[model samples]
Target: MKKQRVVAFVPIKLNSQRLPMKNILPLGEYSLSWYIFDSLLKVKDIDDVYVFCSDEEIKKHIPSQVKFLKRDRYLDGDLVKGQEIYQSFIESVDSDIYILSHTTSPFLAANTIEKALSKMLLEDYDSALSVQKKQTFAWFEEKPLNYELNNIPRTQDITPVFIETSGFFMFRKNIFEGYRRRIGFKPFLQEVDDVEAIDIDTKEDYEFAIQVYEQVKQRAYINN
Candidate 1:
C-alpha cells in the first residue's frame, strides 16, 4: 500500500471586517499567519503546507518552504464563510488527509498537531477537532443550557462543555466528499489548554493573546 499524503491546510484572506488586515498584523515576533505557519513547519507528519489564501502579499511573511493555493475569486471577500472556502478547497485539492490550521488561532503547537494526527489515524477517526473544556454556567435565551435551575451544580461539579476553538482540525481528504463538510461523523474532541485555545477575532482578543503568550513563554508547554 502507498503511504498516505497529509496536507496542512491554512485559510487566510487579506481583508477582515472586525480587525482590518489582521492576518498580516504583527503578533509577538511574527505576523498572525506566520505564527500558524511557523508551528506547522515544525510538524514532521505533514508532507506539505499549503496556504489557501486570496492575498498574494502573504507570501512575504510566511516561510519560503511553505506553498500557496489561491482561493476562489468569489470566496476572496469577507462575506464568505470560512467553511465555504474550506469545502471549495477540498473539492479542488487532492490528498489522503488534511490538517486544517487557522491563522486566527496562533497558539496551536506543532507537537499538538502531531499527536492529533497519530491518534486520528491509529483510532481510525473520521475527524479530529481541537476543543477547550469550558467549565462555566452557560445559558441559551433565558434557560440554562448545561444545568437545571433548581438543581444548580457547582461550577466545578458542572460538566464542562467543549467549544470548537478553531484551533485545528484533522480529517481524511475524502471525509468531506460524502459529508460536504470538514468535520465528519465520529469526530474526536482533542482537548487542548485554555491559553492555547485562544482565538483572535477582535482587537481585545488579540491583546489578550499577546499577554497570554508573554506570560507563558517561560514554561514552554508544548513539545520541547
Candidate 2:
C-alpha cells in the first residue's frame, strides 16, 4: 500500500471586513497568524504545511519549513465564496488528504488535530471537524429546538448540540473534488473544549483570546 499524502494549508487574506488586518494582530511576541502555522507544523501526520495567501508579505511571517502558495487576489474579494477559493487551492495542490484550518482559531490544539486525523484514517471516516458541544436551550423560528417550552429541562439534561468551529477540517481529496465541500456525508464531529474552540473574528473576540492565551501561559509557567 502506498503512503497517503497529507497536506495542510491555511488561507490568509490581508484584508478583512471585521477587525481590519486581524490576522496579523499581535497576540504576544508573535502575531495572531503565527499560532496556527506553528501548531500545524507540529503535527507529525501532516506531510507538508502551506500558507495559501494572495500577498507576498505573509511569506516573511511563516516558518521556513512551511511553503508559501500565492493565490490570486481575485479570490480575496468579498463576493467570492469560500468554496470557489477552496476549489482553486485543491486544484493547485494535489494530496490524498487535505486539512483546512483558519488562523482565527489560534488555540486549536495539535492533539485535537491528531485525534481527528486518526479517527478519519483509522475508522474510514470521510471527514473529521472540530465542533463545540452546546448543552443549552436552543430555539429556531421562535420554536424550541432542543427542549419543549412545557417541560423546561436542565441545561445539563438537554441534548447537546454540536456546532462546527473554524478550528480545522480534515477530509479526503475525493470528498472535496466530488462534493465541493469540506464536510462529507459521514463526518466525525470532534468535540473541543472552550479553550480550544476560541475563534477570533471581531475586536472583542480577539481581546478575549489574548486574555485567555495569557492566562494559559501563566498557568503553564506555574506548572513548570
Candidate 3:
C-alpha cells in the first residue's frame, strides 16, 4: 500500500485593497501567512507545504524550511480570481491530493485539515470543501416560500444547510485534470464551526480573528 501524497498550496498576492500587505501582517509573534504555513506543516499526513506569492516581503517573512513558489505578474493582481492561482499551483506540482488554503485564515486548526482529508480519502470523494451550517431562512427572490406569516417555525427547528467557507478546499488532482477550477463532482462537505471560518479580508476581519484566536486559546487552556 502506497502512502497518499497530499500537497498544500497557499495563494497570496501582494496587492490587497482592503488591507495592504495583509498576508504578511503580524498576528502575534509570526506573520499571518506564517501561521497558516506552520499550521499545515503540523498536519499528520501532508507531504508538502508550498506558499505561492508575488511579494518579496512574504518570501522574506516565511522561514527557509517551507517551500516558496514565486507567483508570476499575470497571477499577482487583485482582480485575478482564486481559481487562477489554484490552477497555477496544479500546473506546478504533482500530487494525488491537493489542499488549497488561504493565508488569511489564522485560526484554521491542523486537526480540521487532517479530518477533512481523511474523510475525503475514506469516502473516496473527488473533493472536500470546508463549510459552516446555516439555519436562517434564505431567499433567492423577494418572496418568502419556506417560512410564511402563518407557518413560522423556530429558527432552531429549521433544517441546517452548509455554506462553503471559501478558506480551504481539497481535491484529487486527477479529478481536475482537464478543468481549471477547484470545484468538481462527488464533492464532500467538511462542516466547520462559523467561528473557525474567519477569513481576513479587511482590518475589522483581522481584528475579529485575533479575538477569536484568543478565545479559543483560553478555552483550550481551561479544558486542559
Candidate 4:
C-alpha cells in the first residue's frame, strides 16, 4: 500500500481585532505561529507545511524552511472565512490529504495530529475533527429541565456533544475538490481536553494560554 501524501495548511491574518498580530506575538522564545508550524513539521507523515498569511511583516518572523502562501488583499479582511483560505491552499497543493490547523493552537502536539490522521486513514473516514466533549450541565432559555447533581453521570449518558476545537482537521483533497466547505460526510471525531486545545482569540486568551503552556512544559520536564 502507498503512503498518503499529507500537507499541513495554517491560515493567519495580520489585522486581528481581538488580539493584534496574535500569530506573530511572542509565546515563549518564538512566535506562536512558529511553534504550531514547527510542531506540524516534526510530524513524520506530514510531507509539506505551508503558512498562509497576508502581512509581509509576519512572514519575516517565520523560518525560511517553511513555505509561504501570500494572501490577496480581498481575502485579508477579518470577516473572510478561514475555509476560503483553506480551499485556496488545497487548490495550490497536490496531495492525498490536507491537514488544516490554526496558528493560535500553540499547544497542539505532534502525536495528537498523527493519531488523528492515522485514525482518519485507517477508518476510511471522509474527515476527522478535533473536538472537546462538554461535561457540565448546559442549558438555554433559563430552564432546569435536565438536572444532575455532583455525582452526575458522564456527558455521554445525558446529552453528549462535542465542541469544535478549531485546532486541527484532517481530510482528503477530493472532499473539498468541489465543495466550498471543509466538513464532509462520514466524519470522525478526535476527542481532546480543553487545555491542550486552547485557541487564542483575545488578550485574556493569550495570557491564559501562556499559563497553560508553562504548566505543560514544567510537567513534561518533571516526567522526562
Per-candidate TM equals: 0.90, 0.96, 0.89, 0.87
RMSD of each predicted structure:
2.6, 1.1, 2.2, 2.9
Model 4 accuracy (lDDT, Cα): 0.80
How well is each residue in 145-181 modelled by candidate 4, as lDDT tens digits? Answer: 3555555666567766578997898888888886754
Summarize candidate 2's per-residue lDDT along 1-224 as a digit string, tens digits: 67789999999998998999988888977888888989899988899999999998887666778899999999999899889888889999999999999999999888889899988777889998999999998888999889988899887799888999999998899999998889998999999999989999999999999899899999999999
* Full-model lDDT, candidate 3: 0.80
> Which ranges of candidate 2 are over 4 A from the true structure?
none
Is candidate 1 or 2 superior in TM-score?
Answer: 2
Could you tell me which residue pairs clash in candidate 2?
none
Judging by lDDT, tell me the better candidate of 2 and 3.
2
Per-residue C-alpha lDDT of model 1 across residues 43-63, encoded as one tens digit per residue: 887889989887779999788
**Which order, best to worst by lDDT?**
2, 1, 3, 4
Best by lDDT: 2
CA-lDDT, candidates in order:
0.83, 0.90, 0.80, 0.80
On TM-score, the leading prediction is 2
Worst 10 residues of 3 by lDDT: 138-147
